[model samples]
Target chain A: MTSLMTPKYATVKSAFWGGVREAASVPMLIMGASFLGFGSMIKDINWSISLAIFTTLSTWALPGQIAMAEMAASGAPLLAIVLAVGFINARLLPMSATLLPHVRHPRFPGWAYYGVAMLIAATSWVGTLRRLPDLRQDQKMPFLLGYGLLLYCGSPLFTMAGYWLSGSVPLPVTLALVFINPLYFMLLFLQDLKDPGRILAVLFGAVLGPITFLYSPDWTLVITGLVAGTLAWYLDGVLKARRGTDES
Target chain B: MNPELYNPVWVITLAAAVSYASRGLGVALSGKLNPEGSVVEWITCVTYALMAGMVVRMLALPIGALVHTPDWVRFIAVLVGLLVFFIIRKNVGAGVLAGSLFLMFLMW
Candidate 1:
């Protein structure tokens, strides 16, 4: 017998509203602008407007959606297109794993957990990570759900808006709109530099990512991540061990 | 190639399915794995590496409309954003706005 009056559930309402408030601000603006650019890009590439909105509604990953739209427009093979987009979105695997342990609760059913997991992306993942440390366990899930719901629903509307306004919108504005997400993520990465392992990983990955892209565009992400990440992890371990030995 | 293969409906559907499948698989694994272990630490590092790789690629070799903008302009914008981010005590929103608006101003 679950009671709504339990202290566990006490923070849920406030956490949800807090999430809504947070999403309604910077994250919402950023996502809307990014999706607006995505919609305009779809229009420019001669993809159907419905398809743009559909991709927003379904995948919600901007990079993967763009890859699919662009590749399909070039008449790339369907299997290849699927594989490329899948690889681009493969980052979500670790991202989901990193965030799930913080938010998963026995109070929520499995389906609800999976549903929220589907909505996790760059914006929500980073946002939740930054905020979760301050929130209670119960608050975390509702906050993420609230934030994800707003972002997921708001994106399609902005996508359609961008598609309709594509012609009238200046090229510079559209470019800036598209630039918002990457810039936001990069800035967030800068904030993440406090962690030594992550700092090394970012530094190594930054150098390797473009170099590998020149060699093999399709596998650049996975290759760079695995190699750079492993290197950083090993280096961090060595440093930690040496520091421990010195302390002893 | 089947004409239907390139259909917008099929393309969007399949792409969504593939993207969701990766994320779903992660969720399924999350329950079984111990988050505090070295494996999770490695996964977290990989996630950071992946994000860093993608962000760097976007800044260095952007596609579509961003391709037209000069590379230095983008570089300066990011530099200025980082500068402001630290100056403002790591306020992400202000830094992002500073950088984005700076790029728009340069292009304008």
Candidate 2:
């Protein structure tokens, strides 16, 4: 593995520009379409348009935002809303941690680290991870910041557009827009199937998630994630140990 | 029910803080944490599991307009998506387009 500190093909400026350039295409479309759907959904629920845009600006994670909107609309308590959104977004914790070491540089102040970390979302995290192996340490932070900034800034506009265009757009088209982000994430998971642990985790989680949902809608995500994930991880560990023993 | 309970400003602020707290905590811990440790491994598993759970929920038990379409149609669309994805060497855009168009057609 190349050292994380080495500068290969990117200075901060070039990497930032590179990130901006990369964000101009598919990621932009994905964010736009998803936020549009979110905006429309909020509108459908009769929530404040400003709130919808605020959710886009703050949470930035589609599922959590959607959960908050839905729950709030249903008159779920504020504490419940917070807990639900927090649990839905719990995945970001690990994602941020995983991506941080690659992007953190000593030259950047501690405050810069946290600010950049705030910008880390699924799009930026995945894009950065995929590209990080090829980038210099100096490039990682700027590239991610630039990429995240574009998506962050553009999302609210799309959200507002979708809010206004909610009823105007055909129902099927709006639904398709909503489906895009989930489908993209699913396919991305499928694309990277080499890791047995992750594959098992996905399979187990898929099987258990809805089943658990049938029991408790509010705690479904947290319960399914913990139970299925731990089970899969344990099973994978056992299998690996047995294989190692056999090989030895 | 108090109308203030549903106030957008308060709800959005609280929700945003809660969400940001998770992301921020991860960043705070990252510097001191070893990514390869067992704890990190468990966290990674949980994240993967959470993502998978959310995807499954979206596909099998969607809310809003998606609930209007037949479940089988959505399932078949996903299947066709996987098929196209493999056939085209895992081109996500093409695969997603195929799935989305298929669903739209079925809905129409």
Candidate 3:
């Protein structure tokens, strides 16, 4: 008889396949729609289909990919393009680091981290973090690999679809497709508002983001994130201390 | 060298390298940081805030075709989605579907 401590899956193959199955749901549609928009945008700018597919494979982050396209089109220098893409994707650093603890296992190969790190898009990061706790420790890494692989491979196809269907699709529908990504993210954040620090971060970001964007559109996300997050962290700390004192 | 003069292949190659570097650096750093420590908590908070900022920017000041829709229409769709989300016990997929359809309806 299997104990409660036993993992749901007996092997890595099962876990990985399970992850692929899990990903063939709403999250997959959200990512598909985003890439579809991206494919069309690249076509609109007359960029090659191969290059567009490469961006999905290599950069793997939507915002950075979009920034690279826009910057390149405007004839921004190479260094400028590099810096813009780097800063836009800096969130991946913290997100990957946070995820490491949850997914690490001794049986998992060390070299695989570098390869899998390429899959750390906002959707994968959030989905993995949210789901890992419910999974057995041994299952986490393989599951992520399965989930990431399916999306990573399937995204290029979606991009190609968007590229071919660009002018044929109605403009308003294409716009709505792009809008789904952010709308999904907003609702997901709302669903996860049980923690004070998280709640404060979202509230503060919602307030400070647009105001800061007016002055520095390129750096607004990082700057607003730093200031609002730090303030929320500090305030949450204070609230925790007060609660502790009251309990005492 | 004039920054304006560059090859497209080099641009894609360099951009990919820069993007991957951020993720690789995080993977390297993750080994050293204590998961339960204050540092991780701080990073978590920052990540959340960063995501929130991205979401707000996309909604309030969208680019491309989304720019055509009136601001109030987008905001109303969000409000409607939120209502449906709460009414249905925080179903994320439902919320997104409701909001997207509503936006399409308003913009249609």
TM-score of each: 0.77, 0.84, 0.78
Listed in order, the DockQ scores are 0.52, 0.55, 0.51
Docking class of 3: medium
lDDT of 3 by residue, A1-248 (tens): 32454336778789898878878887788788778867876776678899899888888887778767755664666766677567657767777877887888887789888778988888788766767777888899988988888888889998898888766777666666666667777887888799898899888988888787677665666677788888998998999999999999
Say which candidate scores most in TM-score: 2
lDDT of each residue in A1-248, candidate 2, tens digit only: 44664334536797887888788898888667778778877877777788888888877887778767755655666776676677667767777888888887788987787787778787778866887767877788888888889888898999999888866778887667666656767888888877678889889989887887777665666777788889888888888889999999
| B67-106: candidate 1 lDDT, tens digit per residue | 8789999999888888998999998878877887888888
Model 3, residue pairs in steric clash: none
Q: What's model 3's TM-score?
A: 0.78
Worst 10 residues of 3 chain A by lDDT: A1-10
Candidate 1: list runs displaced more than 4 Å. Answer: A1-19, A44-46, A63-109, A125-144, B1-15
lDDT-based ranking, best first? 1, 3, 2
| Candidates' RMSD to native | 5.2, 3.6, 4.3
Per-residue lDDT tens digits for candidate 3, residues B1-108, read: 332477667888888888888889889998675655666567667767766876787789865556788999889989988888889999877787788778878887
Find the number of clashing residue pairs for candidate 3: 0
True contacts kept of 1: 0.67
Q: Find the number of clashing residue pairs for candidate 2.
A: 0
Best by DockQ: 2
